[model samples]
Target chain A: MTEAILKVEKLKKYYPIYGGVLHKTIGYVKAVDGVSFEVNQGETLALVGESGCGKSTTGRSILRLIEPTEGRIIFEGEDLVSLNDEQMRKRRRDLQIIFQDPFASLNPRHTVQRILEEPLIVHGIGDKNERKRKVVELLETVGLNKEQIKRYPHQFSGGQRQRIGIARALSVNPKLIVADEPVSALDVSIQSQVLNLMEDLQEKFGLTYIFISHDLSVVRHIASRVGVMYLGSLVELADKTELYDQPLHPYTQALLSAVPVPDPDFKRERIILSGDVPSPSNPPAGCKFHTRCRYKMDVCTKEVPDLVDVGNGHYIACHLHR
Target chain B: MDLDKAGENVEEDYVLEVDQLKTIFRTEDGDIPAVSGVSFSLKAGETLGIVGESGSGKSVTSLSIMGLIPKPQGRLSGSIRYKGKEIINLSEGEMREIRGNEISMIFQEPMTSLNPVFTIGNQMVEAVLLHMELSKKEAEQRAIEMLRQVGIPRAEEIMKEYPHQLSGGMRQRVMIAMAMSCNPSILIADEPTTALDVTIQAQILDLMRNLKKDFNTSILLITHDLGVVAEMCDRVIVMYAGKIVEESDVRTLFKNPNHPYTKGLIKSTPRLTSEKQRLYSIPGNVPSFKEMPKGCKFVPRCEYAKDICYKNEPELVYVGEDHKSSCWLNIEQAPSIEEDAS
Candidate 1:
């Protein structure tokens, strides 16, 4: 049996909403509420939902980029939440994150070589000469030329900048990489090239990925397992094929149906939800999706459905599936 | 509804006709040809989708048509015929009358498009009063009606609020309302939904479709997402390296894409039905404007490039009744319609 590399148990992150002249904490925005999932060794787990559904916050919390207000994160048998600041800094070498906008994440003043070498320097990987060589090697591994090392971030196109970002993420030789909407900003033709390069790098380095994106078609392409998040909670988690073919949660089904298929012959019955996603600071009571769900029952509005196992490693949080 | 009537008259009644429109930017280095010799016509009430990767001149073409391209640095050439008059050489005052009154545009980023200092009501009222010759009170009422028409709940309250107070989706709806306030003959949307969420994207697309029906407006929708083009457009124009590489009706373009670039684009996108282990990506990158190829721009990256393709540029040729492609490949030599399925 395969071993789980990262285990998150009921992780929660809530941002305080300050009000009044004294800036008192009035309420909390429950960004990530009681979310739990596991990523197997060298596997890709995709977290998908709408923009404010807390997918990005969940990814940030798992890496402790943002401190979780509650719950445990067990990585390689160590509770990351229990680590001190200095110890967590040291452990950061084993975990890294790649941001969505490559141009924003990378420093405009720094050269490509400097950007890639900073991670190695931070983790105390090698000396000057070794770091230089490692930077060139990393650039080559991400399908970039060695001569591009001297160029600034603005000199490269969006895709090349993203490749530089990927090289920077892999410089530490991290065990788990959280890529947050990495290729969504890129063009269609460039997107596939970057995705293929990512798959190749994953195989070469045995990297575990937590891919967070709103694009379901892209998630379907890369993820071995998929988790659907809605309004700060995991609605459904299952294998890629099972989730795409037989989605248990109504929200997941609606999301899948909403994606416009490429072919004209294949007609998709678009599930147009009437209203916008409710504010995360004041989510609806009970099931968060009950307000827009077509199959809402009386129990759905009154009771929160637990994430229950529904045969063959699938988990769903819906009263109908229960 | 009169499908035959609509189909037969589409070729004759074009609200806007752009012929060989070229826009070049005079950078410090040299003249960077952003848009080159692109031609297309938009019939009344038809949605034309202009699709391409970055730097493919899709947005540039739309901006040139709307006379929104910045001056001094950029130079516009060729004919942009709107209502049987060439708009490319129109003076600033004349173009100002055309802009927002006859032709309006919605940009990709709503936050930047909207003025931060003013309330939504103030902006909409100003727009309506500027073009419609309405009184301030009448304009305010019209602005409220526009807001309600765009599906913003509690129109009066929303109109009183500032742009920052609204969500991204609401802001986009406000933008649509402002653009539609004048009831322009042509609407140019340049990646309007690219910054929006998927569900919001669908809602906005549906709203635009409904508005097109109600207002009978011609739309020029520019985007890189093929999924949107497939769902929203009656016809599509595929651009590559500052040129229109292919143009066809939506069904024919998806069914039988002619140009190598178009084929590469469709193949690279990961669809819901695609079951391949890995996606088919186009090789290499889009050429920079300064270093464009001498012959066909797509030859360096095309899989079906031949010796003739690199030596000379190919003219846009008629491949079907309403389909055209700029490629050296002989479309007539290919198999029948049934065998050319994508």
Candidate 2:
């Protein structure tokens, strides 16, 4: 097998819930509870879930944007979580993140050229002339003309702003990119262009991506493998085809069914869950999806299901699947 | 499935008609023609979907019909007829009476649409009392009944709770209840379920479908998602750069899309059964209002643009008896199977 670019083993990111005037830690939020996955070079691994499912937290934790309480994050065979502040800062050059909202993530005051050149200057990659040339090259790579580089963030449309974000992420020449809902804020037509651009950039640069999104259709379009998260834990992980064709987890099945098919004649028997996702701080005792799972049994409410490897590289965490 | 034939009878049954409506926003940069000549009509008990990307004038059209477009920065010019009555020239008091009583709208974000300071009961009761000449006690009773109709449990207690106290789905349902409280003849829902999760979105769509049947209210659904439109709308209007590029029954619009933009949109969307190597994306970004191409707004991104497409805008031409699309290509002469395969 080819070497994995990034391997996460038993990662856990728990936020301490504080209360009272003293602000003492009362309980844990368990944002990312014992989740683990690998992203191969030149492949996209999509992490999908609804809001409050900790998918965003997992992406942030991988980049060390937010510190994880416990876990092992191996990047290029080096333990990222164990590294010190200075070491991690130095290592950040190899890892980057593209946030969800383009307007919010980019500085309105800075021009597109400045946004793309800041990473090179911080890393001391090159001098002013070299950095300027590199910024133009990056802009061209993302399908934007060099003349538009001097424009501010608000001057461009949402799709163009996201392209600037991608150009900035590529400026560092990172091996792995954790794009958290990169195109979710964009329009439907613009979403496809961005997805295609990301794919093309991956092929040209040999980059690995952990694409986090709530849209299943977009995830299925771009992802080689997919991981479904619930509350704070990964409920399902499998190849994209296998996961879409034959989802094993109850949550995964329900999620797939809930996605509206584009064809009007294609009538899908939608499995509508009765309630919203429970809060991470007060997740159900046993299975995270037991509160919403239609196939929940007595054991589902009492015992937490273990992620078991079914045949053909498919992994599922559910009592029914077991 | 035979909605193609039903489209021919739409003109006879339409309750609301908007003819060449234009809403221009006076931005600091220039007069941004947000919605240029948008025209479509809604039948009394039918659901008409207006779909487009961000800046494609989907929400602006709905806002123009509701007379809710903020003034000074905005100016609307075009005819809007409700039950054959012109709404563009209606007095403020006349529009006010028609707004909640004859027509109501649900915004994309329910959290922002609802007032946090007021209780759900207060909002619903206020809406009812404003339209109907009902007492406070009568309005509160009707509000509780409306809450229960929307699938909220303990309607009496929910009425007492503030907007922040309920979940996102519940708050949306409350918005729906408020919109329907006045029993408006036409309801405009603008991206009502876009902010919701998949499961909750399904529930909300199902709720809307059920409510439509129960109340017999016509719906003008505005959304960027074709899936929701497929599930809810009877007739679909595909918009781009402030113009309707395609209008057809939902089934025909999906089965045999004509316009290059519509075809690209349908193919670009990731479907549940789609197993393509890569999604077929249309090239180029949507042009700004000031920079709109003189000919076709979609010519820059369209795959089938010829020399003729660059000089003149294509009018909405009849494809089938009911299906219409705006494209320079003679769709009848083009390969039929190729369009279906997309």
Compared to the true structure, candidate 2 yields what TM-score? 0.95
Candidate 2 structure quality by residue, lDDT tens digits, A1-322 = 2578899888898889999899999998888899988878778999999998889999999989999888889998999999999999888899999988889989999999899999998899999999999999999999999999889999988888899999999999998999999989988778888988998999999889999999998888889999999988999999999999988898898899988888788776688888788888888988989888888799999999998888887999999877
Off by over 4 Å in 1: B1-6, B331-341
lDDT of 1 by residue, B280-305 (tens): 89988999988888889999998777
C-alpha positional error of residue B129 in candidate 1 after TM-score superposition, expressed in Å: 1.3
Candidate 2, position A14, lDDT: 85
Query: What CAPRI grade goes to candidate 1?
Result: medium
lDDT (Cα, tens digit) per residue for candidate 2, span B182-251: 8998999999999999989999999999988898899999999999888888999999988999999898
Residue B8 deviation, candidate 1, in Å? 3.2
| Candidate 2 CAPRI assessment class | medium
Worst 10 residues of 2 chain B by lDDT: B331-340
lDDT of 1 by residue, A242-294 (tens): 99999889898888887877765677678878788999999999999999999
- Segments in model 2 whose C-alpha atoms lie over 4 Å from true places: B1-11, B330-341
Q: Please tell me what DockQ candidate 1 reaches.
A: 0.70
